[model samples]
Target: MSFEERDHTADILMHIRAADTIGLFTDAGHALMKTMYRGPARPIEEVSVTITGQSLEHLLHGFLSELLFESEVQNIVFCEFEFQIRDGEVRAILRGEPFDPAIHGGGTEVKGISWYGLSIRQEQNEYACDVLFDV
Candidate 1:
């Protein structure tokens, strides 16, 4: 699984591709991490969450939004994601450490994850999606 930054006029757009549903959600975290912090950080701190949504898109947005909340509130930038999504429910454990401005500040700050243009779809054996990060 992998994620790539794409051009956007007002926000950060990331195209994520993975082998399965879980991978799609997992890579989304990496995409967010890449957008928010440039420096390398170890997974010393852990954040866990269990959330539910109305639909797939809602679940995705909710999950990403939760991560964003943790990042800002805890002053941490996550580097790893482990998620289980089923029946509109998500249980996840994320790893990150305190954000050090000296090393992590060069990256753009993601204020929020946008609902606009957010979508997840399956093509063949792979899952692909796009998420917009409001910065």
Candidate 2:
């Protein structure tokens, strides 16, 4: 799995590539947390999220949005993710610790995950997509 920051006009754009659908979701979650928090200084807590979507693209958007919600509501930053996708639904276990301003340096504050420029497709055996985040 891999993720790269892409150029966007006024938001954050990320290109995610993975070997499978679950990998795509996992990498995207990691990318979102990395974008907001530099890195986890300590792994102290874990959280789990289960969500459903109409399709793969929607699933990705929903997954990222859920991560953002967790950050805002629980004041945590996720560094690791385990994803299970089945029939348009996703079950994810996120591992990380509470965000400490003093320890975990802050990065860009992502307002929400955007649908703009969102695309997902399979090339050969790899799955890839471009996700835009409103910051």
Cα shift from native, residue 111, model 2 (Å): 0.6
lDDT of 2 by residue, 93-125 (tens): 888888888767768898999988788989999
- Top candidate when judged by lDDT against the true structure: 1
Checking candidate 1 for backbone clashes, the offending pairs are none
TM-score for model 1?
Answer: 0.94
TM-score of each predicted structure versus truth:
0.94, 0.93
Candidate 2 stretches greater than 4 Å from native: none
TM-score for candidate 2: 0.93
Candidate 1, residue 30: the lDDT equals 82
In terms of lDDT, model 2 sits at 0.85
Poorest 10 consecutive residues of model 1 by lDDT?
Answer: 113-122
Per-residue lDDT over 1-135 for candidate 1, one digit per residue giving the tens place of the 0 to 100 score = 489888989888999999988888899988888888888889999999987999888888998899988898999989888888889799999898899999888888888888877878889989899899999
lDDT of 1 at 19: 96
